[model samples]
Target: MTNWNATDLPDLTGRTAIVTGANSGLGIATTEALARAGARVVLAVRDPERGRAAARAVQGSTEVRRLDLADLASVREFAESWTGELDLLINNAGVMAIPESQTKDGFETQFGTNHLGHFALTNLLLPHVTGRVVTVSSGAHRRTKGIRFDNPNLTGEYSPWSAYAQSKLANLLFTLELQRRLAASGSPVRALAAHPGWAATNLQGRSGSAVLNKLMAIGNRFIAQDNHAGALPTLYAATQDLPGASYVGPDGPGEMRGGPALVGRTAAASDPAAAKRLWTLSEELTGVTFPAKVKTPK
Candidate 1:
């Protein structure tokens, strides 16, 4: 907690880290920071060429691999093929505020790509994820009612913004519940969640929806901080003296955006009961269980 900025953090020299969506924006910046800090970083992305380019930019040991969260089959393949120990797993890859669609598995596109895919991938890689798992949830999560276990895929009427918010809430819920189960089972791996605090990333680009696009454009033009700054909170969560289920983000004004550092807030994202319920629902949906993991706290 000693002014825990990315540069002030621990050396990840011998650690192996996997960062999803490492090809661009906050993900790319996060990958670069970790690599620079001496971690052997694996660039997991949906685009191979982009991933390789990203891998080349990193300053340390780097590997580029394909990981399409839109396709559960691909997520499974990527996780299974990846072997060996993992010191950090950054579930940073995500799709936001997009048109209504579905994943290869027919789940609502946002929920599938943002939550379930990461859920399954984390489980598949559990044997390797022996150190920490940092799920990148968002402040947007504060806007949602929480994970819709009753209809996670959004089979009925849907709103893209609400869907994205729900997915992000799931991200936090996943992190909290994962830690609870790990503690119960006596595993040492810590689970943490982080947010970018409205940074200016390519992911911040305008969406198909006119109103949302206008809002993004305004943010990008006015308040959004650069990607490197946005990545700090994540970096803090991944390597610092973190507690289980901690939330980290920007240390700037209103946390809208700024330098990588440990900041705090406990909203609906910190609700324990909601997190546990979501955990059980995720395991049921993914058909994957943490073998060493125990029951989530009541």
Candidate 2:
């Protein structure tokens, strides 16, 4: 899909989308584009006031919902309150390479929020999903070897970049397994992944290193694309008629910036065995399992 952009999104009338972390950065841009395309967009953020503020800027049917991916109780509450069909679920909220911290559930922050949180949420709401599930991954997934199953939380040793990379890799693997399950269940839903590829967002500022943050600030200005451009791949994956488990990213060099297109992932990300193992671990950690039957919306 050369030269494809958010402006090329199909008419999304009557659709409903929930974009986590929709209060800022690529999340907000994605919400705006989907709303502009006539979808009823939900700004799912941890902060209700800020979510409302973001929602006010959107032009279509919109609502603000509090959802803290770092907390499992909040995720369950959000999913329990849902009703009817959900056409799109954009798992966009995530923490980057920040200080090594634990989520409320005691899991590593990056893995907990970026992968497990969305993993639990998606399975909880799978029955209502009629269209697609798009989880935002990252090119940084290539930096790490694979999931640290022995000590996923990095209990004894923790590196910010490694944690982030593991979480991003989990994103792709989750998509892969989710699609496999959906297909096996004979469901119409699809699961896809996308990456912004060096998008200029406030996420870069919280790497927990002053020197690195400053360097990233400089790179954000020169090397990164704007939020709208960064959001193209997510939008494309969310709305396009692509294959299950497809990964979309920019078409530019190194997938840093350009139009949306199918992109490759590391072998670790493409391994079905690893995908299944991660899925099992995710369900065990979150206490959320894939639904035995997915109810399709008529």
Candidate 3:
């Protein structure tokens, strides 16, 4: 993988990709990279005007589509209206360490938007997806033990970081289980996961406090990598010939910033039992199930 980078992505002449939250940050970077490699990329965003504007910035073929991950109706609407084959689906949109809030579905904001929403979207669009699914997780997934199945929404007492960590852990778990199901069905489609590792992006401002947002901005200026650099792992996970369920991230000190490389996840993130349990819960919560067959454990 020497000299591996976005510039090295294979020709995607007939490929089509959908990138959620493609209006900015790593999403935009991922979109541009794919587009430049000759893929038709869909910029799926909550704001149509912004998505159109972001689509204009890409050098190659692109389109803009309305998608609000916080709303299940919107997720279904986006999937229902889509047509044709999808070579890639990048579940890139997500909220960060925000104050306790609920999505329109009454689920916790971070967990709902970051995990459940994408879970539903991927399942809904699976038939259209022929190539791969790349989910953006986080190094912060190590901050938590596992999904809070008993109280996923953290209804009683909530910590912003804890919720975010749980959501990220779910991202990895979903990838693992999705790959398992796809393989069980004898499908070629792969599911992979990646983390940005402290990239500087507008995501920092999502937290509820303006003062904290300002502090994050200042701190990121000195510590985080640019969005393009932070996006390398995602680009790698999306286009690379890696094995199914591989986790990609920066290869640097503390995985903060560097070139893309295969990375490790917490043991809890690798727990097949937890992944299966979460997958069952996700299907119940989202009301969307994959066509792929999943073997029940003995």
Cα RMSD for candidates in order: 3.2, 1.0, 3.1
Error of 3 at 212 (Å): 2.8
Tens-place lDDT per residue, model 1, 69-151, is 88878988998898778889999989887878888878898888888889989888877777789999888887776677788
Clashing pairs in 2: none
- lDDT string, candidate 2, 4-31, tens digits: 8778889999999999999999999999
Residue 287 displacement (Å), model 2: 0.5
In TM-score terms, candidate 1 sits at 0.92
Candidate 3 on 1-298: residue-level lDDT in tens?
3347788999999899999999999999999999999999999999999999888878999999999999999999999999888889999999999988899999999999999999999998888888899999999999999888999999897999999999999999999999999988878889999998889998998788889999899878999999998899999998888999999999988988888999999999999999999999999999989865322222
Please provide TM-scores, in order, for all candidate models, with all chains considered together: 0.92, 0.98, 0.96
Model 1 misplaced regions, further than 4 Å: 1-4, 259-267, 293-298
Superior by lDDT: candidate 1 or candidate 2: 2
Clashing pairs in 3: none
Tell me how candidate 1 scores on lDDT: 0.83
Clashes of 3: 0
* Residue 119 miss distance in model 2 (angstroms): 0.5
Q: What is the lDDT of residue 253 in candidate 2?
A: 95
lDDT of 3: 0.93
